[model samples]
Target chain A: MSAAAAAAGLVLLAAVGACAGVVVGAAYVAFMNALRVPARLAALTYTRHMTRIYEAAMAAGAFLAAVWLVFPYTLRLAPAAAGFVGAAMGVYVGMLASALAETIGVIPVVARRTGLGTWVTRLIWFVVLGKITGSLIYWLYPPLVP
Target chain B: MPTVYLKPRDSLIVAPGEDITLGMLAEFAAEDHELERTLRGQPFLPGLTEGHGAISVSSLDLVRAIRRQRQDLDLRIVGPAHTVVKPRVRPNPVMAGIWTAAVTLLLFFGSLMAIMFFHADVDMPLVHRGVYQLVTGEAAPRPLVLQIPYSIGVGVGVLLFFNSLSRRKPSSDPSPLDVQMHIYDQDAQDYLVSQSAAAHRADQARQK
Candidate 1:
């Protein structure tokens, strides 16, 4: 891509990234709430923790935004980049999904017998699986994805 | 008299010998320290002054301390090594944070789909050609390939989700309870106040 084209593409990508940020941020918040045990922690502490998580999630998103903003539009865009992005996001998504199931779903179902510790372990594994799957998908077929 | 939370990653700012306190932390916060843009397992939040209560972050210290904590995350080859991903499990805090990101990604996807589907018949090529000529005076036929990279950019968002898991290295490291101080930012404070008000209202209902 020419410099001018590259610059224009960056501006467009930046706008997209800024717009996508809202979604990524909200998902992080929901995931965090799911991870916590309700009716235990005080509201202030909970908010504090949530704010911390929000900041962290956004910080991570900045990198994503940069990647998007500077995405090489050259037809030579590598397929591996797909896996790289997929693995990062997939792990993140899987982590949130697992947290929702355990904290909200399983916690209510079997909160008594299974310890929080056990739930957390399973959740981590779930996210790891997501990263692996995304990476595999990107490596195998980075172009024209589902 | 006070509790302070110290992470191994905190770089002490006091010259060789000073104390750290809430007031000093506030001053230091205003001058130098701002909230971290992202989350890392190593405690970069509210670092203690090496010698004083001041919160100034010397570049060397922040750099050195955080690196020290991350070193434990390296993978081992032969020796009994803790996996780079630590604690071997998900913490509630981490889980809640991650789910929010996923949901956010989903929402963005929905929006993207809605945009494209809403305009299915629109030839992005024609649009691109028109803009390309207007902007650069180039008569290129395939200026529409510009959208390809942006599409791929979605993967970057996806990658962030995966890295969140790896953000904190698992360790036998205990919570930095040895130090306990809370810094209030406007956003955090506002959230706390709103939640507190909600709790108070709920409590009144329960009492009634």
Candidate 2:
């Protein structure tokens, strides 16, 4: 690809990504709700209005996240702060991704469909391990996915 | 002595004036048919005279109420100690609508951001270009052919995956969201029951 073509492709890709982002984000939140994170948080706090607060926080957080993702920048943080941020992001992403699977009753449905009733626990461990491995590969060697 | 095995429910919704019987509050199995029938029929709470909200009842309370009538009964209480009795009332339409709208908007924006972030992170445009070039053996500045179909596919894929197309669902199967909501409801109810149980324990300790 020529230099001009590559630049144009990047721009076009950004446009497509933005559109795809909206759909994915909405679906992610919808699935997150299925996981009942907001509900559980509200119940834990013993506040009826906590759900609204949680939703608002999520919306604002997501907006900030989008901004961070789109604008290429490097932040120098203390190791502790970096660790905390990484842990928080990991938790949020993990829960959101798992929500899609759990909400759809993936384990139960897969077990029933495959007639692996006895291996339900094993299947769960497999999913967990599989996710960890895939994530490790993606982060460790991004070229694999690309 | 009748052995009554009591498994307390997490929550029960009742009408304002409805009588709450032992059977409605908990699942109890007893050896003696006559005693079981009598215990099940026993009034736990006198028809709510005034209140129209939740009233937590503990297993201890149930056992006490049962023992009041039959001192010779042996009660084995299993599961959570409390049951939250809520009034069955239709929610206000306006409030419900507002809540729904707020949630819908929030989720839409949040998910959109997440997807965009992932795309930007991976440099998806470059990926697309690579795939397009590999397939066609030509460098197209704007791969509308591949991009357009892929974009449309994303939306359709979401609809199918979520099992919802607007309001008219394509299938009778419960959507993932529906299943999650159910699970959340169950979790919330369990939390409430446990909370009530803890409160009951604290109250008893204070009384002693």
Candidate maximizing TM-score: 2
Q: Positional deviation of A37 in candidate 1, in angstroms?
A: 14
Shift in Å, residue A79, candidate 2: 47
TM-score of 2: 0.51
Docking class of 1: incorrect
Candidate 1: regions farther than 4 A off: A1-77, A105-108, A111-146, B1-208
DockQ for all candidate structures vs. native: 0.03, 0.03
lDDT of 1 by residue, A1-146 (tens): 69999999999999998788768767755546555322112231335456556556656755554454456223233443433443443333333433333333332222213323223333333333333433333323424222
lDDT tens readout by residue for model 2, B1-208: 6578999888888877889999899988877788777778888887664446567787888988987887887789998777888876655678555644544444345444444455458675575554455445566555445554443344333433344444544254554545554565566677776776788779989999
DockQ, cand. 2: 0.03
* CA lDDT, every model vs. true structure: 0.37, 0.59
